[model samples]
Target: MTALATAPTARPRPARAWRAVMRLHRPALIFWGFFVSVVSAVLLWAYGPGGNAAAAAWQRPCTVDLCDVGYAVDIYHLAYRFCEALITFLPVLVAVWAGGLLIGRELENGTAELAWSQSVSPARWLATKLAVPAALLTAGTTLLVLLHRLLFDAHQVPKGWNWSDNGTFEANGPIAVAFPLLALALGALSGLIAGRALPGLIAGILATATASTLIGLAGPHLVPWKTSVGDLKEGYAAPSGVIYGREGAVTSTGAHIPDPCTGAGKACPAAHDIVGYYSEYHPSSQFWALQLTQTALILTVAALATAAAFTLLRRRTS
Candidate 1:
């Protein structure tokens, strides 16, 4: 009887932890749910009816050479641009939420300390916080990315869209998902370091923006660029691809040098002893390679930031 009376009840730690996180961030979760739903709906519409109408409109004969593309085409372009813009800025939004609300507010309000006193180690708490959101963000972003890719693949026109465009490239692959995770980690780290909501928010935004900018600038160089050479008489005959470098003259000795005269008439090639013109670019075939490389880089940074957040939390709690 005494043994039974003295026995402590076994609480479900995982469930309780999940519930605590959900309760604390219910508002953010609700907003996220709404945002994902609306974006998904827009993407689906664009994928099915909207895409079909736009394609049909393009097939229609125009009375004039410069005719209007019709309302369907306009709407489809608007939807595509709108979705792309939102997805591109999702990381910034995530950074704001993570830095200002997720970690910073709790630390500032003493809620984190209170929770720590209630049998929740700071590490577990941080892990739960990151895990839940990372899952949610990944799921939402993955769905949006698949939808965006479908839309892009189906509705692409030769003149207006290219796989290598910044907005399109980021939205159409795993980078879409990876970037939000990176932003979340950056924001959490910023929050931990700042130990205040406003400072954390500002720092998080700056860090995320800086990281994103650097990655964007480095994206083209992540993979080996293919060079295309064309005879001087034939002019530059590079295939359609993402041109990363200016067209330059190639000497018979295989040296690449600036064109002595871009506009100096046909005499320029012979005068400079240029045998051909060369261009450095990434072809459509290398799309996945580049995308995967960028995704890996972003994920690595996210992991580092996550580790830093945990380390900071441990030091503060200990």
Candidate 2:
């Protein structure tokens, strides 16, 4: 009884921390909720009424002069493009909020320091900062991704839509979820490094953009490319696929060389000692492999950024 009376009362630190975070970022939280709801509704409409109307428009018998595709196609196209663009660039938006408002503004305005003084270590503060947003971002992005996939898989998208297209590919897989987390991590690191809101916002955006660009460029090479070879008379014989890596003449000695007959209509393959033509590309079957590979890479970078942020925070505080 004496010990109990002398001891300090236990407190729910994590719950308190979570509540504090939510209260501080209430505006951003509201905006995020609204954004997700709007996109989800758009996707649902496209998947149901818009898709049916578009399908019916396509099925209409064509007159010689005009297809008469109707407004449904146009509306569906607009909806799809809007959703794709938003989902694809969701990370940049996250980066902006994170760097500008979440970490940078707090640090810039002495809010973080005040929190640290209130029996909350810098580590715990940072953890709450990252974890709360991370959870929300993950949930929201995952829902968007699933909706996008459902719409795409319904086979009602425009004719030119391909699984390998950048927006479609990212939105259709786990990379959609992974990228925003990366953006959040990057934003946090930028905020810690800059210690100011505006600079942190710019740096975070550039960093996330650069990382995304690099990953996109490397996506084609993430898996083994399928090759199709054909004799000179048959010309190039590659099947339809994404990322046509290489298309050139194949010599009898199995060496690759530039195709001399590419533009010349009557050029002889024999002049270039070309026995056949080869094309290297990624087939549709490689989609999952590529997506998973990119997701792993992005997550790895996010982890590194998170570690760097903690290290920077510790150095500053210590």
Best model number under TM-score: 2
lDDT per residue (tens digit) for residues 95-197 in model 2: 9988989999999999999999987999999999999999999999999999999999985744968887768888999999999999999999999899999
lDDT: worst 10-residue window of model 2: 1-10
Query: Which regions of candidate 1 are displaced past 4 Å?
Result: 1-15, 64-66, 156-159, 241-243, 263-271
> TM per model?
0.90, 0.91
lDDT of 1 by residue, 75-105 (tens): 8888988999899999999999999899888
The TM-score, computed over Cα atoms with residue i paired to residue i, of candidate 1 is 0.90
**lDDT for position 129 in model 1:** 89
> What C-alpha lDDT values do all the predictions have?
0.88, 0.90
